[model samples]
Each structure stands twice: as structure tokens, then as C-alpha cells.
Target: MRTNKNPSEPRFLFLITKPSLQSTLLLQALKKRFYNEVTLKHCDVIDSSTIEDGDLLLFDMMSLEEQTSRQWCQDLQNCQKKFKTLLFNIPPHYHHRDIVEWPMISGIFHTETGEENLIEGIRTVCRGEKFFPKSINDYLTQQLNLSHPQWNETVDLTHREKQILSKLRQGASNIEIAHLLFISENTVKTHIYNLFKKLSVKNRTQAVFWANKYLR
Candidate 1:
């Protein structure tokens, strides 16, 4: 499976219960779209020996049993290195907050998700950025606020702070944020520090978490 030895290349391993015409078509499309950049695989279980950092594990939720799907997600979490996981073909009526809240989940797609959106989501997740929909994010945020009432208090964020926070939520580095905003690295750091204080969070991850709950 490690036919490509280039460490810089991105690998995609699709874990489905079984193959179908839809899966075959989707794989073909991804191959054509990504060219030689992506390596595709289908397996019954994760083989740590072949896994690499930055590899994406796409779970076909529509094909797998509920308990099995959740277990596979947990198994990914226990892997030695960091890897991105995306749940696709999720049922509209499914409500598994535990899987949604898992740290390894980079995105989720429902059965109704369009092909274009799914392709874009795969690219986004592979780039180390999360790709959850607004509805899912809003639901998580609402649940967070319900659990922690202190965050319910109104906290006004400056226009600039909000912009910086949004970038942070996208997993942008300090340098990337500075470049995108056309601001100095020092200025970005200053804004980040100020926002951290305002959000009552110490670091970028916590600040992003706070924003996910408090901000839209």
C-alpha cells in the first residue's frame, strides 16, 4: 500500500463496510481530480504499519453499523500519530454527539451532501483545516453554551478581533494570518494576545474553542 514513498504526498484511506457502484464512481472522480497527489485505499481495519501522519480516514457512515463506526473513530484516536478523520454519508436523523465532539473528526457530511461539497471538504480536511457545516457548528456551539452557562454572558469582540478569531478557527498560523490580513506579525501577535485576554483563554486552540461556542 506504500507504493508511493514520497513523504510529502497526501494519502486517503476510505474505510467502508463494502464497495458499491457509488463508492467506485466517487473514487474514480477523486482520482481524476487529485491526479497523483492522493493514494486511495479500502480496508476492513486500520493497519498502523502503513499509516502515516496527515493521512485522511474517511468513514462511510451510511454503510457501517452505528456501533462499529463509533469504534473505528475511537480506534483512530488511539493511533500513535495524528491523522484526520471525516464521516461521510451520515444519516440526517443520526444524533451522535460523542462522535461529533471527538478531537480527531475533521469534518462530517450527510447523505444529501453534493459531490462538489464532498470534494471540497476532502481537500479542506487534507489541508489540515476543519470543514464542518454551519448547522453542525451551530449545534455544537449551542450545546457548549448550555453546558457552560458562564459563556452565555455577552462578550463584545472588536471587528479586528473577530476577524483574527475567524482565521484562527480555520487553523491558520500566525504568519498566515498576518499575510492574509496584510498586517505585521507583531500586530497579529498583539491582536491575538488581546483576544486571548478578552476570551479568557490562554492559547490559540482555547481561543478558537471559545469562539466556536460564543461566536457564530
Candidate 2:
């Protein structure tokens, strides 16, 4: 994800909790292989001009140091207009919500992450996409295996919206959805827009993600 559409362009900022020569080495390792496509620097998130540009800010902060990180996120949220932040929080506490739950933070990684996870997370972050790893998902699934999940996605779903999304889940196109529901194609578009808005998703992929996650 450090690689941009233009190879010469860099799209990331590496924010370290405490700067050191060791971190300098890590920066060299990060950028050496990614081509001339990223700017890596050791910085304190508190007073970083590098972090203010709405670029991805990779923090190597810890959860025990929560207030500082929250202030850092609040600052980013206030100043940045358009960006996705990727946070790298170390072990013993992955619940660094102050930053990770910010709309700016599009992805998060644990200290124990592998190369594949890091790569995929960066890619997803660049696309403004959200990702929860299977290990995290598996851990959550075990704790929350209590009972049925109440599907409230359909609460705002109009009778027609539910029917429309059901058709969508069945892989129906606008023409097919129109025909199946006995509505015009134009009306179908209106309903589809409503579905997208009601579900708070801009595209079909997110709609499907929300549907499969909560509606199913």
C-alpha cells in the first residue's frame, strides 16, 4: 500500500513512539524494498508536521500510554481532511480504541503480525477499507458465541428495501430486480440508492459485507 498509482509518489508516514537509531534502521528496511514510493521517518506523534498532511500515520504506540495516543488521534482527526491512518499497537493490549476507532484509522495491526498480514492491511488501508483479521475474529467469535445476533440492519430497511436487498443477495441485477419486484428500472435505481444509504455503504462490496455480517 506504500506503492501509489504513480511509482514516484509516496503515501505513508511512519510515526514512532520514541525515536532511536534502531527505528532509523527499520525505516531503511521498510523503504528500501518498496521503491521510491514512501517517506519513512521517526517522529513523536505529539508535534509531528509529517503527521498533519492527512497521510497514513503508522504509530508504534502502546495501550498503557493511552492518553497520549488519544490526544494524537484527536489532533489528526481535527487537522486532517482526507486520509486513512494505520496504527501499529504493541502486545498485551490491542484495545487502542482512541485511535483505531477514529474514522481516520482505516486499519490496525498488532506487534506480532506477520509479513502477509502487514501487506494486506496496508493495501486495505490505502483503499479506505476496513479489515479484521481472522485471528481477532476467531477470538471474538469464541467470547460472543452466546446467542443469536439481533439483526437490526433490517430495522431501517423498508419492506421494499428488504425485498430489494434479498434480491441483491440472490445476485439480481437492476433489470432483474425490477422485473422480480415488478418495478421500473428507474425506480430500481432509487431503491438501490436508498439501500446503499440506509446501510451506510457506498458500493455493493460494503453492502454485502454489512449484509453478511449483521443481516444474515
Candidate 3:
């Protein structure tokens, strides 16, 4: 959840590993699109003095080596800026899974992510929301599967809940689930809330994790 002091207007600071002509053009496009709602700034490095407490930090990972990425992740963790961070251009086989565990990282962007989706992701994160692409979520599922605990088959779940979980595992949103299940959106929300309690999970992502761990 976002705790922006001024929710009406939020600032964005993008930290690129190395600036280029292409990046400059991209920033100009972004500014043109988001001129009314967002304030945008780009830097080749992290500058804590320029960052505010509630600002959103967009970290471009395209040019980072593995060791350098790890070091920067640690630095961001230790920094006192308290800014929400989003990582973009993460490699598909990225080795540093610990980056996902960083509490300050509010979202991730993959190399295959489309430009429109990237903009939407930035918008979502700026609004104090976390944005994890389906690919990233699938990667997390694979990671969880490797070290998953033994399933307690007796953990009771209703047929409907199981159905919902199945759709969730396929990355269906609540609206999509409701449409497919021939139920009201409100009912889907109700079932999701109850199912989360039954599964001892918090969000849809965790529920998907639980499903993959046990259902598969």
C-alpha cells in the first residue's frame, strides 16, 4: 500500500546505470505522456540528496553486471531515502533472487516487457502499488517449487476455492476469474478473501504460490 504524503501528485526519479541517447529519447516520451500527473527525472547514478522520502525510484538494470547489481541492491537497502523502488530490464535468468526479498522493491520489469506495459507499471508503482509482471511471478513460482514443503493434502479447500486457485495459477485477475466462473465480481472477491484465510496466504501471489506448491 502507498503512503504518499501528497497522493494527488507524486514524483518519480529514474536511476539508469548508464545514460544514452536512446534513454534520453525514452525519458522525453515518458514526460510527454505523463506530463500532467507525474514529475520525472533521470540520473546515471543514485543521488540520495535529490531523493525525497515518498518518491518512486526507477532503477534500470540493463547495464548492471551481477556483482554490481548485488552491490547496488545492498546500497539501496542501506540508504535512508525511504523511496519506493522499481527494477527494470531484469534478465530472465537473474541469479540474485534475494533482490526480490528486498522490502523496498515495489515492482520489477523484465527485458521482454512491452513499452506500454512498462509505462503502466511505472504508473502503477507511482500510485503506491506493486507491479510484478506475469513472467516475474512465474519465475517466483518456479523458485518456490524447487524448495517447496510437503503438501498437507488434508488442508480443506472448497471446490469453488480450488477452481479459483486454478484460474489464479494461470494469472487470471479477479475480473477475469469472475467472468470465467460466471459469478459476480463481488462474489469473486468474497471467495478470494475467504480462500486466502484458508490457505494462510495474504495476496493473490501467495495464493498462487500455495496452489503451485500443493496443487501441482
Candidate 4:
């Protein structure tokens, strides 16, 4: 596993998909915000030699069938270099929740994910964290609850944290959340960090998942 302690170094992000306008625009958007922190690259083919340890691979999920996707994931796992993988453009009703168990897959990006969420997901995965869409998380939670029922543990959070979490479940951005709560964005960030810690989640998506499963 590659450790990235230095924040100044550029993280190589490889997009594994055919060239298209949408892909180009996505790369441009990433460059605009993370130009100093990320280097964008594209490859139509997946080759071991072309990948490097610590590189982040963004796979276009729409480009592969279920079996092919599994094979590709296996190939990545067998590769000599270790890299993080993120699957994007997955539909809400996607049936491959089992894909989450794959160690190489660090995150799953839904079609409805906002730009801010997308950027945050990338950063979260780069930090050796896993990301999942709320729907998938909800599904897995349901499955786990069925297989092994246990008394629910209540987590205590501040009133403000609960308010912010409610907004987050509604897909509100930090700025929108701040506006709704009549608080500064920085204050929202502080509350968000606190909530993440309390919920034992790393990103907004996972936090929303926790809120839906317990708070709802």
C-alpha cells in the first residue's frame, strides 16, 4: 500500500474509459479545483505496466457488463502494482452491491452525486477510505440486520449535528446546509467533522447512510 503523507505532491488520477466529451469535462473540472494536488490522465486499456502504486483509477461503470466488470476487478487485484479503484456513473438501482466487498474498490460514485461530493469522494478514497452511495449502504445494512439482529446502539449527537445531518440526508451541500442552519460554512465544517467522528463514517455519503439507518 502506498502512503501519501505529503499533501503537496500531485496524486495521479487515471481515468479508465474511452475518450468522450463528458470525460473531458470531468477531467477539466477536477483540474480546475485540484490542479495542484492531482494530475489527470486517461487510458482506454487496463495494463499493469501503465499503472503505478498509489495511483487512483476511476473506472467508468457504464462501460462494462457485470461479468466483465468482475473480471476487470480481478485483473486489477492481480496486477503487480497496488492502486485504488473508484467506480463512477453507477445507477441508483445497480445490482452489484457485492462489488463493495472487493478490496481494490475504494468507492462507488452514483450518477446523482454532485460535483462537490465527487471531489470529496476522490479525496476520501485517496486517504485510504472507502466510499459508498447511500442506497448501497442502506441495502447492506438491511442485509446485515436480517442475518444478525442485535440491539441498536444509540449515538448521542448535538442538536445542531442532528439538524445538519437532516439536511445532509436531503442532499444539501455545505453552503446550502450552512444557509439553512443560519451558520457559517466553517461552523458547518466543524459540526460535520464532529458528526463523522460520532457516526464512525468518513464522508457525507456514509454519514447520510448512518442517519437514514438509525435517525430515520
lDDT of each: 0.68, 0.57, 0.66, 0.68
Which stretches in model 4 have alpha-carbon errors above 4 Å? 1-10, 36-44, 139-216
Task: Estimate the overall C-alpha local distance difference test score of candidate 4.
Answer: 0.68
Residues 15-100 of candidate 3: C-alpha lDDT, one tens digit per residue: 45466786666667666655533333444344445655666666667776666666665555435455677788787677446556
Candidate 3 has its poorest 10 consecutive residues by lDDT at 36-45
Identify the runs in model 1 with alpha carbons over 4 angstroms from their true place.
1-9, 13-17, 36-43, 46-49, 101-103, 145-147, 150-216
Error of 1 at 135 (Å): 1.8
Error of 3 at 199 (Å): 20
Alpha carbon lDDT of residue 120, candidate 3? 83
TM-score of each: 0.59, 0.51, 0.54, 0.55
Model 4: ten consecutive residues of lowest lDDT: 144-153
Name the regions of candidate 2 deviating beyond 4 angstroms.
Answer: 1-10, 40-45, 48-54, 96-99, 135-216
Selected candidate, larger TM-score, 2 vs 4: 4
Instruction: Compose the digit string of candidate 2's lDDT tens values, residues 33-147.
Output: 4454455443343654444333666666552256776666545533423455566655644553333344444666777876567666766665556666566456445433323
lDDT of 1 by residue, 1-216 (tens): 444344433464554445778787877777676654444455455454555656667777777776666566545534555567788888877785654644367888888898899888887776667888888788666654434644433578889889999987876556667888999978988999988777665456457677776688
- TM-score of candidate 2 relative to the true fold: 0.51
